[model samples]
Target: MMISNTPPPPYYAVIFTSVRTNDNEGYAETDALMSELALQQDGFLGMEHASSEIGITISYWRDVESIKHWKDNLDHQKAQIKGQKTWYSQYKVRIAKVERDYDFLKK
Candidate 1:
């Protein structure tokens, strides 16, 4: 997804940044599945993603508890293991609470 249609501020964002290994076997399918599964999670607001050599995905959440739940999800945990073993060379995750937000769109 591009810009995430999120709720008002004071929510949380989990920023996942990764650099892929040369091998991408099953990466696309796994990534798609993860996105779909994330949407099914409780308190999941939305997500934005982009990739080149480096990949970045930011998922919005209602609270820290929600974020923690996503992390501990069984399928997601499997994906994380797969990513570490096959897909990603390096990765980082950051969680932050949004205090305020504003956007301008041209119609």
Candidate 2:
């Protein structure tokens, strides 16, 4: 499948999808924190997103180890726990490695 501004070859993409709970407290704060930390991580590259209720954020990373580190990061882990308990009604994370990619932009 063709995606806009396809990620460069040989990168890891962490696809995050979430259904937010309307009454959850600290949702925006935690979400923002996660984004900030992700950008600062060792293997961080870049990200793109299309979000609403069921949102998707694909973050590019250097390798599996970096991705795994993010997965187990203390702050992010706390946020994940909070999300499961109070923020997200449901969520799923999928990681994929891109060996090749292509895109077409309007001229």
Candidate 3:
């Protein structure tokens, strides 16, 4: 799902970029679960994701603390382990503060 209702600027964005391995055994299920769990997190703003040769999932949070909490979440940790072992070939995570943002929507 596309996350449209993002909060106003000055939030945090965790940009997860990954290259997948051929073995995708349980990737989809785990990914869906992670997204579901993130929504339940305290400072979650929203998320936008896309996948192809390289996959990118950008999750927005209220602050760095919230992002840290999500990173250390037990279930998420497990998913990380699984991704390291099976799903992803390589990945990079970058967190940045959204200083300003503007968008135009076509009706």
Best by lDDT: 1
Q: What TM-score, to 2 decimals, does candidate 1 have?
A: 0.96
Q: How many residue pairs clash in each candidate?
A: 0, 0, 0
- Each candidate's lDDT (Cα)? 0.93, 0.83, 0.92
List the candidate 2 regions with Cα displacement exceeding 4 Å: 1-7
Candidate 1 runs further than 4 Å off: none
Q: What TM-scores do the predictions have?
A: 0.96, 0.85, 0.96
User: Cα deviation in Å at residue 62, candidate 2?
Assistant: 0.9
Write model 3 residue lDDT over 1-107, tens digit each, in one string. Answer: 75557788999999999999999788889989998999999999999999888999999999999999999999999999999999888999999999999888789
Comparing 2 and 3 on lDDT, the stronger one? 3
Relative to the unseen true structure, what is the Cα RMSD of model 2?
A: 3.3
Those runs of model 3 whose alpha carbons end farther than 4 Å from true positions after fitting are: none
lDDT order, best first, reads 1, 3, 2
Model 1: per-residue lDDT, tens digit, 9-75? 9999999999999987898999899999999999999999888878899999999999999999999
Give the lowest summed-lDDT range of ten residues in model 2: 1-10
Q: Candidate 2, residues 14-48: lDDT per residue as tens digits? A: 99898877875788898789989997899888777
